[model samples]
Target: MLNMQLANKYAKAIFEVAQDDGKIDEYGTDLKTVASEIDAHKELASFLVNPQIQPNAKKDLCAKLFKEELSVSVYNFLMLLIDKRREVLLQEIVREYQTLSNAAQNIIHAEVTVASALNEKQQAKLIEKLEESTGKKVVVRTKIDQSIIGGVVVKIGDRLIDGSIVRQMQSLQKQLMAN
Candidate 1:
């Protein structure tokens, strides 16, 4: 809980800075890159969070690795995390920043699970329908789940619309059992 709060604070600060500089998108990309790199390399991630490593060395390593791709402010932010021993929260911070960015841009991300992959026309139609319903710029990410049997399930934030054949069958079975 404390970690999430701290991550939100740091993410908000950097997000504001990026917004002011008209570089929010760039910073988002950079933060994602850093998070992805750390996530992809277990040794580097372990090193960042390891209490055995000295703070200065960790900061130095971060600077050396990210200097080329990250902006100065972001680089300094990473160093600050090292100094504060919050380097382990980098991924959370990046996720928070993305949330902030999306809100600022009035963008909504929806995950659509379908029994089969949608073609270009179907994907576009789904996105358009979602946008019309939500009144926001909707970004649809799709996944194929054969277990759904047919139809689609859409999840946005805390709300879920389940139109899958499996779910329908289960609902019908429950009603018949209750009867």
Candidate 2:
């Protein structure tokens, strides 16, 4: 709980800084890059989060590792995290920052599952419908789930739209049993 608050604080601070500098997207990309690097290499992540490591060493290592990929402001932010001993929260911070960035850009992420991959026209139509219904730009991540049998299931935030053939068949079966 306390970690969440701290992550939100740091994320909001950097989000505002990026917004002011008109680099919200770039900073988000950099944050994801840093988080991915830490996630992909367990030893590197362990080193950063290790309490025994000196702050100076962590800061220097972070600077060296991301110097080419991150901008000056983002590099400084990494150092700040190290100094504050909050380097372990990088992944959470990145997630929160992305939430803020998406809200700022009026974007919503949707997970769409189908029995098979949607063609280009189908994808475009789905996105258009999702945007129209939500009144926000929709960014979809698609998954193929053959068990759905056909049709699609769209999940956005707390809402789930189950339009799958499997679900329909189950509903029909239940109704027939009741009758």
Candidate 3:
């Protein structure tokens, strides 16, 4: 809870800074990329969040490793976190920043999973329909789920639309049992 509170605070501050600098989109992508790298690489991540390691050493190493790769602003921003001993908040801060950016832009991310890949026509139709329904920009991410057997599942925020064949079969089985 403390981490979330701190992360939200940092995220809001960063969001404002990035927006003012016209780098909100860039910062958003960089934050997510760095967070994913930390998540995917276990040993490095462990070293980063380990309280046993001295903060000075962590700052030095992060600077050496990321100085050339990251934007000057991003590198400086990270150094500030290190100085504050809040490096562990990076992932949460990134997630919160994404939420803020999306909200500010009136954009919503929607995930659609189906038994097969969507063709161009289907993808276009889905995007058009979602745009019409939401009155906001809907970014659709598609994934294949063979286990669904058929039909599709659309997830937009907390709302889920499951029209999959496997779910239908399960519902029918449950009805038969109840009868």
Which candidate number has the best lDDT? 2
- Candidate 3 weakest ten by summed lDDT: 63-72
Per-residue lDDT of 36-97 in model 1, one digit per residue for the tens?
99999999999999999999888788888998889898888888889989899999999999
Clash count in backbone of candidate 3: 0
Better of 1 and 2 by lDDT: 2
lDDT of 3: 0.89
Number of the top-ranking candidate, with TM-score as the measure: 2
Model 2 weakest lDDT span, ten residues long:
59-68
> Higher-lDDT candidate among 2 and 3?
2
Where model 1 places Cα greater than 4 Å from the true spot, the runs are 167-179
Output the lDDT of residue 3, model 1.
91
Tens digits of per-residue lDDT, candidate 3, 76-124, equal: 8888888888989999899899999999899999999999999999999
**CA lDDT, every model vs. true structure:** 0.94, 0.96, 0.89
Count residue pairs with overlapping backbones in model 1: 0
Q: Residue 179 of model 2: what lDDT?
A: 100
Q: For model 2, how many clashes?
A: 0
